[model samples]
Target: MALSQLEVTGAEVYATQVGDRLTQRGHQVFYVSDTLSCPHKGQHFRLLFNKRSLPRRVWHVLYLIYLILRYKIQLVHAHSRASGWSSYVACKLTNTPMVTSVHGRQPVHRSRKKFHALGYHAVAVCENIAQQIIRDLGVPREQVSVVRNGVDSQQFSPLPAANNDKPIIQIIGRLTGPKGELVYQLLKQCIDLNTNKVQVVSGSHVDKRFAEFEDKVEFCGYSDNIRSTIAQADLIIGAGRVAMEALLCKKPVFAVGEAKALGYISLDNLPAALASNFGDVADDGKTELDIDYSNLAEQLASFGEQHQLSEQLVAAIKAEYDLDAVCQKLLETYQSAYVYTKQQEVPIIMYHRVTQDDSQKGAYGTYVTLERLEEHFQTIKRMGLSPITFSELAEIGLEHRFNHGKRYIILTFDDGYQDNFDLLLPLLKKYQFKAVIYAVTGTDHNRWDVEHPTKPDQRFELMSHQTMREIDQSGYVEIGGHTLNHPKLAELSEAEQQQEIEQNKAELESLLGRELTTFAYPYGNHNQQTKQLAKQAGYTFTVATDSGPIGMHQDLQQIRRIVMFPSTTKFGLWRKIKGNYTYKKASKQARQIDE
Candidate 1:
């Protein structure tokens, strides 16, 4: 892997772990991380669930691109939900096979998480999880595989009979959150004055919690000999790496209430004892403990032989949840996915306004007036270029290259303006050109009321520029919804975003005798949600204000076009017809010297 692979996860520890694991198996792994994170035990990793902070999450996209390059990577694997999705998109870009190990639980799962879950090769820790992931989560059955976590039996074997030690009950956790206090309380509750001598050690002590527990317990904040800590202990309580380590150390444990259990496990199904904390429990009697701890003390008296815990955990290691096997499976997924990426052939052009003068001078491209537009139209006609709509070009040409002999162009305008009425209309009529205009829906309640170089609605057909109402009743216009507000699509709720598309389509179709099938992305900015909303709203094509010729690889909401203007000179316009628009001379501000 190259340093560029940093685009995928960006979690140094995750990258490091993945790197180290692959290296141990003779595969090279590249690592990149943007910033540090709070250390959880000895393992420091970035949080995947912070919804309010996006820049942190955005740091991983470049790593995603790194994954897209067809490297010899056999498989791709990730630990967290966000990283998993990031990896999937990147790997999918490269047609590489990929998979994710459900690392406990996601911190903040959104509704769109189902789509992320649907894309991966799922590997749960056990069959119970595998089945639940399939039933409750949207993970496809064909892609999901059950891989149990492993334990190092050699180093973590049961303690020797020669060393006589009192029953040491160990609970290990990052001494933060309620679990730290809960462990202390539960240990204080379960160990009896009548039966067992209790001793306790914690791996990670949240410093504040340490002050509180200083008088109550031994403050071994973290330990290098975690295996030994578990081996010496008669019983182990808590979850995560320490819990797994304890089991390998041949110690019995009360393993529950950590990530995999606290968030995912249904509390109601638990024995009136362990179920209270999925989110919050008020009247739900099944969540909190209703059982007597005094009775549980007697139960521990016969809690089987020493290391019986290790024996029972045999299946966990045997399940092949080891990183090696998991990575191998992941490689297969990436290979197939990377091979599947089609060449990025489609050009998604964007446009804004159609007139002779620039609305925002020297910022957006200059506008081409009617005289210049006619020159350009004549050139396209002479070149045998089909003036097709966004949908027609995509279908006839991009679909299996059916129209290989035909050069096609789509005409689109952004921000419904009036010059398109008086200025561009007659020109379109002269050339018999067909085009689509994404009208700003809210200005003057969607009407072209503003008077500019020309009066509104004089030359071109007025499309519904209504922000609140439908546009089809306007007769001469083809209603295309812009948005409720022209805010960037990335910064809106999925519901609000979807509503913008829907309200436009529904109102326009309702008013017009026809159906509304076109959409314009507000502010020419859209994210995954906006794209999805356009699809759900049933639009045939969506236009943006970017520069590219229209074609297929672009999503429905991201089709391309050229903005026609009023000030565009006829001689300059001819150059655009011959692809000068893409050349440096067209871009250069030239000064012709008089001879």
Candidate 2:
């Protein structure tokens, strides 16, 4: 992880918490920052650089490159623009993966707009920041993920409110930038310091302007025990992390942040509060730091009677901002980035049916004879390509499997033709290769295509339940879900799609007595709704035919596959597997559509 500042900023705190959690999971984490804080267990390297100076920036880049090489870093998580700029260059030069977390609203400028160093995947701490990066920084929407800042629920659990005649209204944050100005205005004009026992907990020196209220307001300068400070407060005045921490502690929070002021966080206004990251952002895209003083004063005045925390609000916070869930998302993102960086593409070869007779070749050109299948297997072995299942590929990342520069391909047999069990299983055992069979659990034949009047010869027998179980236990074939019955998912209603997808998964898991992780779209036809249903059905990956993002990791739910036909020659299959076949095929189809 690379952070521009080593101070106790939100970004720094987030990185520290993430680093600690990752370390506990038995992963090595390294930090490169402006200074050495070493708050967690990790190797910290300092590479200070002035953002505007060319010489210093170049020096930082070289130092980052050295650190990456020395530590043999697998991925870099950049936190700020200063570190992002340098770390991005180093990652590009070294061929290492990097994911940048947009901690807050970024300043818009020509250079920043043109070349935002958000790495391979940009992680936004909130939806507001994600929008800003995509709109102003010109980042591709697909490359960005909105992962909110997480709070350790255990460490900051709810505490009983202090019983005081005067409520302790504590404002916590660094008294600088727009936040400091907002704090000054709120203290000077908005709140009644005499009636309410106000406290300011900041790392910065108390401004001279705050001298008049010094006696009335308690200025606790930079206490390390932030949770203790928060526990003492009756009402927390902050935004982003502070608001999240306070909410987790079951305290009333006046949502005031650097961007704008959202009066108070309640169950009714919680959605709005979350949309703006508890007021660290303005959802309307307005930059003005406006605060409704009258409304703030009213909320403060009736704080005791109106500002009661609810269990629902606490549950919402825990659901969205739990440290474990957030870390899991980050870890998944890291794995994807690492895979993408390590291997740009993996050939997912798709096959439908294998037969012994050329007379049974269907009109759809979806089958290859057993002789040809064996020839293809020989070619695969001769080319030194190993066939692996999707589950294996996902569990063991590309780097580990591709060690010693070994190449691999995923072999998928769709529709689970009976020949897969009788014919393909022998070849798989002969070569000791693994394959995935996407089985439609509700049927025993290709009725969807065979029942068509124009495609009578396409009739093929699907594997029976006993055959499926036998193949699944063979240790060489993984049975994936292919829906309850093959249907054009795009033409189905949402409920129908859900039923087809979920029911197929449930039945398959029950029959196989194990969970299925991958699903293939029937006829490679799906819409956004179908894809979402597949995800909601718990399939980690869903395959599509020749239509998906250029990279497999780009969209896991809609991965591209190479369709192998009976006429596909050895050289053609090799080209399709080794070359950029998906991209070329997609481009050709796009051109034909345009023409």
Candidate 3:
């Protein structure tokens, strides 16, 4: 069903577990990792080569391509930072679906160069990590899913607390860097833990230097019986999978690692703890070894008080972080990712005013006569193209919605003209077509457009707020943003740009009482700064005046649209939808008439 990019880490452990589960469900699974640590039954494994060896990395990619072709692999899931680079290239080259799981803190450096990681769909192990991926990696939030790493509840189930004179505190993880260094410092500082009976379940990969402190600790090096060993502890300290397993085992877990330390996984702190994926959240790389043994002891002293809390914590774990539930969501992601990567392009048609008379048609390209508008709808229906609103496209994603060779078209009207409500609404209902109308907030006319000297007076009135509300509340319409005051954004200062973009969004959301996530630039004029402002303003997708098909590969901001005029023929509309019409080449002639 899929392949994994792994190393000897918690990410690998998760990948192996998922692979094993997939195999159990009668799906063929393969794993690519640095080493085969605890091979799951009925699964195939391949070495990913040394991390630093360039030749081997190149060879790994080649091998992956071969595997994809040989096994007919449907998807590739990359884990951890090191494997992301190679797997990204391999999947992109092979035209395979790729999903990258951010299991821990990834300090990704921002680059102006093409973002290779952007192409792959992301699965953040936690909500905090998901937001980081969006902020740091510049990946859209829609492209990232929060699927926390899961633990086998049955295997790591809680046992009755063992009798002890004093409270015992333990740290569990591989004896290396983040976990190893932090645990080493904690072990040295807390000598009282020996009398309190501390146990270290060091994983298979151990630093030889850990032997120096062996006499001071009950070092259970490389234990296969982790659950039972963990069951014997009074209080558990660990990170990542260990922390999750500890929580499932009904222990007071102190999550400490390379990421931030979530002091304790309790009912009170459960929400915050879960958001950080039980302490695997990203920090600015400054968190040090800060242990709170007194706090741990205080919680341990009142075992009866924590009894109800323990039940709540376990219930939260099963509800949110259960292995079966997480994997079911992941399977859906895998299927969607495959379809998304192979999606076709769709044409977005833009209009402004629709009127019954041709009197105002020549005054500006904005006006399309009612007959022509009806003809356009008939032509679209005849061609089997389903009309959709921009919000619907944004909600479903261009790829997932348009992937199955489905002929879909978006109908967008700009400037909030009154004629749209009067003349266009009935046509839309007749055709059963969905449309998006971008309203310039608080405006009652196209006041931003200066009247042309040669054209007759075309008094273009805008739809009133009452009319906009009616159309917005209609199931067929989505009200989008055009700006508070329609101004050429490229000509405005950043502050003015913010006022235009952000203020429009705020005003519309306030008026509609629903999120306005799509925007259309005024006169289709904008710069890179304008796009940034729109994104910062929280618009999910923005449309520009440029003419081109909207494909899965297109950026959310600066989505292309084919603006129609009175002269645009049915044949021309057909050509445009088929991607054969060169609108840019014909813009001069159209501009001559409209301008």
The model with the greatest lDDT is 2
TM of each candidate vs. truth: 0.43, 0.79, 0.55
lDDT of each: 0.48, 0.84, 0.72
Weakest lDDT window of 10 consecutive positions for candidate 1: 1-10
**lDDT of residue 495 for candidate 1:** 81
RMSD of each: 19.2, 4.8, 10.6
Which of the two, 2 or 3, has more lDDT? 2
For candidate 3, write residues 488-545 as lDDT tens digits.
9999999999899888888888888999879999988998999899998888888886
lDDT of 1 by residue, 1-595 (tens): 2121112222223345445554665444543222333122222333333332567546555445653453344345665565665666666666555656653433324564457533446655445445555555555787676544433445565564324345555555544455555555555565552344444554343455345545556656545556655655566655544444454454555544433232111122322212222212222223243435455455555543433433435335323324456555444444333322322222223344455544323233434545455666777687676555554554453332322244555566555556555555566666666555555544433233233235443223333334213322322234466765455777878887777677756655654446666788765688878877887788877776543232333345665433445544445444444433432321232322221
In model 3, the Cα lDDT at residue 217 comes to 72
User: Candidate 1: TM-score?
Assistant: 0.43
Assess the local accuracy of residue 560 in candidate 1 as a C-alpha lDDT between 0 and 100.
Answer: 43
Q: For model 3, what is the alpha-carbon lDDT of residue 137?
A: 64
Model 2 is weakest, by summed lDDT over 10 consecutive residues, at 397-406
TM-score-wise, the better of 1 and 2 is: 2
Q: Which is the winner by TM-score between candidate 2 and candidate 3?
A: 2
165-241: candidate 2 lDDT, tens digit per residue? 77899999878778888888888878888789999998777778878887888998876778888888889999989
